[model samples]
Target: MDTITHTLFGLTLYGTVDKKEMDKNHKRAYLVTAVGASLIPDIDVISRLWDTAGQYQMWHRGITHSIFVTPLWAALLFLICAVLFKTKDKRLFFLGWLAVVIHDTSDLFNAWGTGYLEPFSNDRITFGTIPIIDLVFWTIMGIAFVLSKKNKKKSPYYFKMAWILMSLHLIIQSIQGFLIYNQYDGKYDQVALSADFVPWTYSVIVKQDDTVTIFQDNLFQEEKERYVLVSDKGADLDYLFSRRPEAKTLYEWSPFVVVVDDGKRLGLYDPRFYREGQSFLYEYIER
Candidate 1:
């Protein structure tokens, strides 16, 4: 999910809690815990400043987003609350844990996956069932916010209902993606999916040997061929990697890539992100 969505998740979670009985200081601590835990996993972005080996691709959304690290983040936040607010509530730790866990787990649903297992595994787990910015989630949260304002006494209930609706949206999208993915099974050697901003729509990338095909798919409409890319199997990547280290990182980071090797240039890009004549994720080095 994007940063803004994560922030909304934190605020929604806070709204779900009934804090009417808590003192002002305790309420502040809870709010801090929710927002801080939600934003902490993205702290891995700072790794760019010290990344010298062109490993920023692997570093961002890496160990910091790991489930194993969630508890540690919660513990740190708990300590911060204790020191700053002089509040010793054990429930604060659990609330922080929930927020951090949700942050890491929700990222697994998108095309750009996370290193949820981290030290135990380097695999980038992704369902590719949800878009990076899901408008359905925004709609649910927006409605909940409005309803909460209209009925302050039932604010917690309204937010809880919002969470349920968001979960249902994910379930529906995942099922649709699964059905679309199955249509190409056994037809290609490898397949990858990238969900579109609109629900029930997906960009499907299928690779068979040197050829890669991109298709726009939707549950209600016939699939459309978007682009077909060919990879030069004999392209020497040593020179390209030496000239542009980020190219190597991009290759490693992507599930699969369409390699281009004309005599004039060498480049690679993920077919799943191909759009408007080029992919934003493309990395190349000129010959």
Candidate 2:
């Protein structure tokens, strides 16, 4: 998920807890706990500054987003609250866990996955059932916020309802994506799904031999082949890697890439992100 969605998740979590009886200090602690945990994992963004090895792609959603670090993040938040507000409420620790876990877990539903089991494995676990920025979630959160105004005394219930609705939406989307993904099973050497901005729509990338095809998929409609890229699978890339080491990293980060070795320029790109004649995640070197 994107930063805005994560921040909204924090606000929604905070709203789920009734704070009517708490003093101002306790309220501040709760707010900090909710919002801070939601954003802590993304602190890895700073790792890019010192990423001399072109490992920023792997590092951004790496160990910091691991499920193992959830408790540590929670404990840190708990200590911060204890020192800053002098509050000893242990419930804050569990709330911190929920916030951090939600942040880590939600990222798995997108094409840009997370290292959920980092240290044990480097695989980026992705379901690709949801778009990075889902308007459905924003709409649900918006409805909760709007409804809270009409019933301030029970605002927490509104946010709780929002969580339930969001979960249902995710479940339904995932099931649709799963069915779509399974349909091409064993037919292609590799396949990846990227959910479209429109619900129930997906971009399915399938590779066989040196060819990659991206399909615009809507469940009830016939699929459309959007792009067909041919890869130079036999190209020698020792020079490219030496000149642009990030190209090597990009090669490793993606499940597969369409290599271009047309003599004029030699490069590669992940077909999943191909748009407007270029891939945003592309790293290349000129001849």
Candidate 3:
């Protein structure tokens, strides 16, 4: 998910808590806990400053987002709140943990997955069931916020209901992605999904040898073939990698790529992100 969605998650979590009985200082601490924990994992983005080896791709959502490190992040936030607010409430710690956990867990649903199990595994565990920016989540949160303002007494319940609805949306999207993937079980050697910005729609990339096929899919309608890419199987990638190490990192990070060797240019890109004759995630080296 994007920064905006994560921030909203923080706000929604804060809204779910009933703070009527708490003093202003405690409420302030809770607010810090929620937003900080939600945004902490993304601290790994700073690694780009020293990423000369093109390893930024692997380092951005790396160990910091791991499940193992989630509690530590929460504990760190708790300590900050403890010192700043002079409160020792154990509930603060738990809430901080919940926020961090949710942040890491939510990222698994997108195509640019996090290293949730890093150190134990280097696999980028992506479900590709949800878009990077889910408008549905924003809409749900927005509506909940409006209702909370109108019914302050039941604000917590309304936010809780919003979380339930968000969970249901994720579940439905995942099920649809799974079913669509299974439909091409033996048709392709491997398949990867990237959910469309529009709900219930997906971009399916199926690789069979040197050919890669991309499809725009929706549960209620027929799947449309979007693009057909061919990989240059015989091209020497050594020169390409030497010139653009990011190309190698991309190759390693992606499930599969569409290799282009047009004699004048050598490039590799994930078919799932291909658009308008190019891909934003593309790495290339002019020959």
Candidate 4:
């Protein structure tokens, strides 16, 4: 449920549904709307970051991402679009809402989990399946988006294939998560390194050294003792910028700090949890 994937769902959903108006400007607008909607679910960040983190804990992606808030967000977007563009295209409005709904669906498999049924409960929900981002999955969709942008004629097919592939991959991840839950009864951390565990870009890795056991975000499965946070591995940014080249600007402000250099990829440590002993968790990557 990082920003990127949600935006991709929004942009592709809008693009596929409104094929006739696929001009350069229209495509750009789609990208903008997708990015906006992706961020909409995170508006609670402001309160969480500025006033108090618990404020976000209370609401965060809770309400905005729920079934109830989905419609409200769609209606709000519809009204704004009506005022700004002066058009009442119900198809477009519905398409926009569909994007929102689909965004939540995608989040169901994300590693950090989401609250689709918030207020009713504060518990985060996830199948504990797919890593937030899968390289092959993202690369395929990214390539398709690139091809579509270059050759307008093939854009529809490319976009459709990309979405389909992403959806299928997510589905597999969900099923796997459910199976793991049944087997482990929530005893296991739910995320392991390989397919024997779950092959994904994001998952909760349980690290146990002696007696200290804690949850570690496993985006890159390195050594048994080494793990990286999904965000540190570029989970959120990768999703948002996957389609829109312009939105790269939004990720310019990285929440983590660069700690070391391996000559190939730079090592990063999340400022939130960087401290003595824990400093060894720094992960490296180029760019």
Q: How far in Å is the alpha carbon of 39 misplaced in model 1?
A: 1.3
| Highest lDDT model number | 3
Cα lDDT tens digits for candidate 2, 1-287: 99999999999999999998999999999999999999899999999889898888889899999999999999999999999999999999999999999999999999988999998999999989999999999999999999999999989999999999999999999999999999876899999999999999999999999999999886799989999989987887778788888889888888899888887788888888888888888777777
Runs of candidate 4 exceeding 4 Å displacement: 21-34, 180-183, 186-287
**Reference-based lDDT, each prediction:** 0.91, 0.92, 0.93, 0.52
Candidate with more favorable, higher TM-score: 1 or 2: 2
Stretches off by above 4 angstroms in model 2 are none
Model 2 residue pairs with clashes:
none
User: What lDDT score is found at residue 77 in candidate 3?
Assistant: 93
After TM-score superposition, what is the CA distance of residue 11 in candidate 2 from its true location, in Å? 0.3
Stretches > 4 Å off in candidate 3: none
Report residue 170 deviation for candidate 2 (angstroms).
Answer: 0.5
Candidate 1 lowest-lDDT run of ten: 278-287
Q: What is the clash count for each candidate, in the order shown?
A: 0, 0, 0, 4
Could you estimate the TM-score for every candidate? 0.96, 0.97, 0.98, 0.63
Give per-residue lDDT, candidate 3, residue 276: 89
| Residue-level lDDT tens digits of model 1 in 1-287 | 99999999999998998988999989999999998998899999998898888888888899999999999999999999999999999998998999999899999989888999999999889889998899999999999999999999999999999999998998999999999999997899999999999889999999999999999998999999988888888887787888888889988989898888888879888777788888888888777
Candidate 2 lands at a TM-score of 0.97
